[model samples]
Target: MDWRTKLLNPKQKARQDYKSLVTPVYRGSTVVFDEQSLIKDDWKQSENGYSYGLYGTPTALELGARICDIEGAKHTFIVPGGQSAIALVYFAFCKSGSHALVPHSAYGPNKAMAEGLLRDLGIEVESYDPLIGKDIKKLIRKNTSLIWCESPGSVTMEIQDVPAIVKAAHEKGVPVALDNTYAAGVLFDAFKYGVDVSIQALTKYIGGHSDILLGSVSVRDDSVYNVIGSIYMQLGLAVSPDDCSLALRGLQTLAIRLEQLEKATFQIALKLSEIDIIENVYHPALTSCPGHEIWKRDFTGSASVFSFTFAKKISGDQVEKFINSLNIFKIGLSWGGVTSLAVVYPDLVRPNKDFEGRLVRLNIGLEATNDLINDLEIAISKIN
Candidate 1:
């Protein structure tokens, strides 16, 4: 063979039996086959064997498998990011003329998709109060196909009564899906509560370091798996093998990270609640949160992200100043990373109330507890 032919050869010369404590990043677009008869393309790579990289390389599948093992799911699909995970569930469960119910406090992008893309597609998503647990049945319609619950919802931090909602939806033959990102899948048992579908933005807790963008959609059973899997394949939601590798590493430290984050976050939330200028602290473990009892009953533990509101005396501009005044807490969005962050939601609103820019959300990191508290104290002082 010519020198060019040797250079283009796909066969490996090095031994492939290398073993390590970590999963290696598998990157490739084509999966070569020895026989033409074996050539195929299938998304059920776990059962049917790897046929194409579009479905998932070994690295992506391994991450999905680990999430499934942790979450106790029948199957899990890895998508590009948390929003994609929500999109997958929405597309899978709702179609033209299909009606769905979502909490008013769901992730901002989730609500945007519902009002925008899903609405444009002829699907109607109605928003309901997050606290309307079993009474959710009252809102169910003949066309109601999907119900979404996000415990400790977005910036408002409402811990939903998931079991009650699940029970209600199940009785009416409707499926309940949860944005389980806040609980990081492990802290809360989605399947145990009768949730049909559980999705997470692995970009937050599972990624741990905020360096990767990934998400997972785990189903309670094979029946639900088939429903989500079919749409997952058609959407061509491919993820980077490198990002999967990062998330795989993130899983190793998740338990310890959650432990420290929970402790530090609760401490900070408690301190904030005592301040006269802070009207409320919306941590799930605290009484001030909307569904604290439900959280205690349903969750094994709380996570790092929570929200707080300034007193009426504190203007929206003052809230922004407080966030900017923080030295250690960076001004940013997203949560469950190694760095503490703070951001204000000036335009946040529910049915009867609006934050009026006094609402601020915080993501506590693994920083020293006292240091974080001091940072918040100093910022509050500056605003005062």
Candidate 2:
């Protein structure tokens, strides 16, 4: 049938003949060609054709192809990390004298990128409320080139109406790029939802071990892929072959890990709601979440990444005490690993003026739910 089917069902003879369980990490700067032939010229001349390791190797190609399948994209470009994927899309589409609409409740760095770097490049970045729905049409201008979105947005976790924004942007000949890292591609199909470009940071759930950092941009059409691919080539953005291998390996177990993590996190979120200390819990699965209706309509699953607001003021020392009291949840950066993590989100001040409270973002890992809950209860009781 198709390549995906073939990959899933390799013959026993093929398996017996193969020497490696994993794809051999193709390591080298330049790919060699036969002597005195046009093949070398093709390698150097064609954009999609391989010339050097940075352009792509077998290892990276395998990962990109797999991600493309999952994203329902015609083509894919692997980058250094999720943030770089976002940056690549911005640089590729946004030029000097252009304008872009960005959701107010975006990842802080994305907003910073638009304001600090894109502004310097003469690109005007305008922030619209994520809850604006179809009203986003009001913010679009004649010069608008891109509409940047993040569902279940950063710390505040506001999920936007993707279809409305996509329809509006496409009507105006603008492209929509979504940061789908939160839902991961398994739960939210970006292409199905009308996103022109979908970005994911493999550093989060894809590379579940947290041992590697990688990112990819999956384009809905060949034309858009060509545009992103051209910019990627021109900028020389690439991921290491080893990192690709790790991410690929992690992909095999992603579904199972996500199920366990979601189950654990949902239970923890329910318990958080019962605690008087927690003011608000921003998990998409929770009914109180701002965009739960949209989430219930569009998404198939949720991740362990959710935030809770505290009712009372607490010092950095008290925050540390709470974190330190946890026996299982480690204080660390990044998530989707086997072990649970808890972080005091002191820097998570929402740009949206309506959101105000001290917060902590928890990434419930593949741990016993009761033990994690008990640890949290003990730690939070100590918070003053």
Q: Report, for every candidate in turn, its global Cα lDDT versus the true structure.
A: 0.94, 0.84
Candidate 2, which segments miss by more than 4 Å at Cα? 1-19, 40-49, 313-320, 351-357
Which ten-residue region of model 1 has the weakest summed lDDT? 3-12
Give the per-residue lDDT of model 2 (tens digit) for 1-384: 688998977655444476777887888777766664534422222344666787777888888889899878888788999989989999889899999988878888899999999999999999888888888888889999999889988777888889988988888888999999987777898999899999998898899887988998889987887778778878877679999999989999988998998888999999999988677898999987989999999999999888887765656567668888888899986777888888876655544353232677888888789999999999988876
Model 1 segments more than 4 A misplaced: 10-12
- Residue 136 alpha-carbon offset, candidate 2, angstroms: 0.7
Candidate of highest TM-score: 1
Report how far residue 56 has shifted in candidate 2, in Å: 1.1
lDDT digits (tens) for residues 1-384 of candidate 1: 787897998566888899989999999978998998987788999998888888999999999999999999999999999999999999999999999999999999999999999999999999999999989999999999999999989989898999999999999999999999999999999999999999999999999998999999999998999999999999999999999999999999999999999999998899899989999999999999999999999899999999999999999889989988999999998888999999998888899998889999999998888999998999899987
lDDT of candidate 1 at residue 270, scale 0 to 100: 93
